[model samples]
Target: MDVFPLPLARIGIIGGGQLGRMMAKAAKRLGCTCVVLDPTPGSPASQVAGHQILGDYHDPSKLRELAEICDVITFDIEDIDTETLAQLEQEGHRFHPSPRVLALIQDKLTQKQAFAAAGIPTAPFVELSEPSPEAFAAFGYPLVQKARRGGYDGRGVSIVKTPEDYDAHLPVPSLLERFVPAAKELAVVVARARDGECRCYPVVEMCFRSGENVLDLLLAPANIPSSVAEAAVDLAVRTVEMLDGVGIFGVELFLTETGELLVNEVAPRTHNSGHHTIEANVTDQFEQHLRAVVGLPLGVTDQLSPAAMINLLGAPGRRGRPIIKGMAEALAIPGVCLHLYGKATSAPFRKMGHVTVLDPDIETAKRKAERVRDLIEISAEDHP
Candidate 1:
């Protein structure tokens, strides 16, 4: 096997969220610098990055400055204006996963169609300019209406169970999708290099709370039939091939009651489900993403142990700086790792941090994970 040299001294990240913060930390470990561009002065990534560029995504001058300073650019969020990025790319800026890939995945309608065109199976869906009663009738009731652009973490997504429910929330441009009756939700994280080399991590089974997926409890190396796991990985690889996707691609899937797997969605970067890989895999997703984007050799995706991840969300009816009421109790659990994103304010349904637990057996890991999750509680109160 031929070894590839690392890129330049510094890499630029377009978002200053927790994902970017973690990526910056990984880069620093490799003796590389990470420069983050975000409008917020106190953004999570900015706190850890070697340098920070405070500007809006639409500011071309700032983009050009970032392009001049860093070897390659990648994004932690897809909400950035791709048109501007495309212009920068033409002017000698190099972007990972490419602006074209970001453009396609930013819009839910285009993303779903891309899956079908790639010969990937996904739930039936129809695009809508206005989610009216008649439009809802076409897709049938108990369907999901999601904004084509700028939706994440259960926001801008709603279920229309009946005609009355549809009438209540009208005048929104969204996509109506058939809600697949799923037995389990699974996800696979795949990383692909610019040279087309790719590797997939072990599959993860996900559980949602209260019809909203804000809180995730992930079971790694999902205890599914071997055939099912293989199929999931195959689908993920195919999707990456179709997009010519670079860096980490997270393929969210639905395992139906009929033993069929359907692609739910694709996130073009590191994802929350892959968070367990940080402790359980030979190489974590952040490093893999860096390697892929910089044209380096991909890392091993083999699992070292069974793991589970629980997301901590802020409790409702409370406001201000967040506090984990039972942090010491949760941290006391053996083999439990907690990661808190440094955010000053907390609101209902906001993702504050995550907890990961590992064990030799999947069930035991899940039990320990639940215990840790139960012990910790996030309240929107000022923490002295």
Candidate 2:
């Protein structure tokens, strides 16, 4: 299908975080205007958006106002109440990826069920009334208990390694899943248009911090066998098709020691793992998402270089404002690009920003990314 040119439309984004900021920037590049609805005045997206609507996500009046002003509505965060989106849809407002998709993916239990219903393979899981002894016994030891909703970036997730740990944090309803002994973690970013056209970026291998779910490094065009990479991309494509997605979809996977693949989770937006595409791919994930959501034909997902992305998290004891040190030294490295989210405050383990390093070889990019990560520091006193 040919690209549908909607006349100079204004898009309304629900969250004003860094993702929204980047998405808005991409929209601007495509000759569209963005109006961000966020409670905070100085949000990252608001900083770049032409208009800002200050209101809560659940406020119908605010949503109606946004619907009236914008031609299409989308979201940066999935935590918003889907009921409100559904209500807006009833009034002829357009929402990309639709409210039904958001409702299915917002809760871990619901997401898992949807995956199963779609015939997608995922780790075995059981919905528990509470993370109690009985729940642990049912799922077995060394399981992961995840909150049904509102979890991201290593929060609302816990590993129940033993009975004692399970007993310690009981009485909360959670989803218990058998923990796969993953040899490596991989992720694929897939983009789909409203007309069913889709494309998937090269698979990325993710390295996590020890004993934590936080990603430390992401290497694109994963250093794996061709079959494994193909399988990962296939899974991502099938998952997005099942969701009837109309924008970027991130599929996180676990590659087991026996070379089996299991779906870990999915994010219905441009993801952190795909951030390297901004500097390394012909068409970045942010731009592809805009194209998909706005009924434009999806862009090519070809890689321009072997890239590595290292997340710059706020260090321990860092508070107040952030001071990035050695940025000059880091930028001195060839093919290194630093991107810091314009956040004013820093807290331990908070995702301040990321740096993407591109090179002819993956190993060289990885080493350069590590050096760049070491050079950047977040001090408490330096305000944005």
Candidate 3:
């Protein structure tokens, strides 16, 4: 293999959330500078990035400004105005995964349609031109309604298990999917270089928060049959390869009780599920994404240790400057790595940060992760 020289690059990130913050940090390690664009002046990514361009994701002028100053651009969000990005790309600006892919993935229904057209295995779904209780009943009970666009962190999804649940259905263009009684939720982060070289991280199992539908805990190298793990990875790799996208892709999968694996969704950027990779993998997803976008060789995706990670969400009823407690106690535990996002305020269940526990044994790692999860509390400083 010819030695690929690292280029001194300026990477522009579209969203200034925790994902972008971590991606900016990884770029810094590669001797690259990052400028983040977000509406919030002091957004989480802006706290650590070289600079931030304060603007909305859909602002065409701001997008152009970001493109002019940076060698390549990527997004931590899926809701950006892809039309502006597509125009920028035509004007010689580079975007990882391309604006076309983002446009498709931004609309949940369109994404599913493409997947189905490509012969991908996914849960049965239908586009709801008119999502009425009658229509929902016709489709059958126990359905998952996902907004076609701009849904994230469990905000734009609703579960209509029966006629009574129709009152809670999302009042927007959406798709109704048959709720799979999944035995487990798994994710694989795949990194694809500009030249089509691809690598997949070990399969990680996801456990969502009750009622919130947000990722709560994750276990790396998901405890499952070796054959199942292999099948999961294969499906994930194939999914990314099919997209033909550069940069890291997170493929969320549903493992049915009958031994079938289905693709739940795909994120075109580095994802929350791969957070433990920062401590356990030979190459973290953020750095891998940077390498792919900057035309460098994709890094090794080997897991160096079994790991578990838990999200630290804001306490339910606290909404002010975040007051994190038990950091000292949590840090004292062996193999505990904590990351706090610099958000100015906390809201109920808002993603504040995360903790990753690494141990020789997955079970031990999970126990330590849960212990850390309980030890830490994120509340408002003003809370009485």
TM-scores, each model vs. reference: 0.95, 0.96, 0.97
Backbone clashes in each candidate structure, one number apiece?
0, 0, 0
Error of 2 at 162 (Å): 1.8
TM-score-best of 2 and 3: 3
lDDT of 1: 0.87
Give the whole-model CA lDDT for all candidates, comma-separated: 0.87, 0.86, 0.93
Q: Mind sharing the TM-score for model 2?
A: 0.96
The TM-score that candidate 3 achieves is 0.97
| Model 3 residue-pair collision total | 0
Candidate 2 clash pair list: none
Which 10 residues in a row give candidate 2 its minimum summed lDDT?
1-10
Query: Candidate 2 lDDT, tens digit per residue, 1-384?
Result: 555464456889998888988888888888788999888878888888868999887787888899888888988888887898898899899998799998889888999999888889899998887555775876688888888888898877887788877654535677888878899999999999998988999999999876557999999889999999999999889998999968898899999999998899998888988999998998999889988877777889899999999988888777888877888999999999888888778888788889999999999999999988888887676454
Total residue pair clashes for candidate 2:
0
- Error at 86, model 1, angstroms: 0.5
Query: Clashing pairs in model 3?
Result: none
Per-residue C-alpha lDDT of model 3 across residues 1-384, encoded as one tens digit per residue: 555345479999999999999999999899889999999989999898959999999999999999999999999999898999999999999999899988888999988998898888999999987778788988998999999988998989998888987899988999999999999999999898998888999899999997999999999989999999999988888888878888999999999999899999999999999999999999999999999999877889899999999999999988998999999999999999999999989999999999999999999999999999999999997744
Q: Please provide, for model 1 over 1-384, each residue's C-alpha lDDT reduced to its tens digit, 9 standing for 90 to 100.
A: 754355345789998888998898878776668889998888888888858999987688887788898989998998888888898899888999899999999999999999888778999998899766777887798888888887889877887788888654535677889988899999999999999998999899999887665746999988899999999999889988999878999999999999999999999999998988888999999988998887777999999989989998888777688877889988888889999989777877788889889888889989988888778888876666
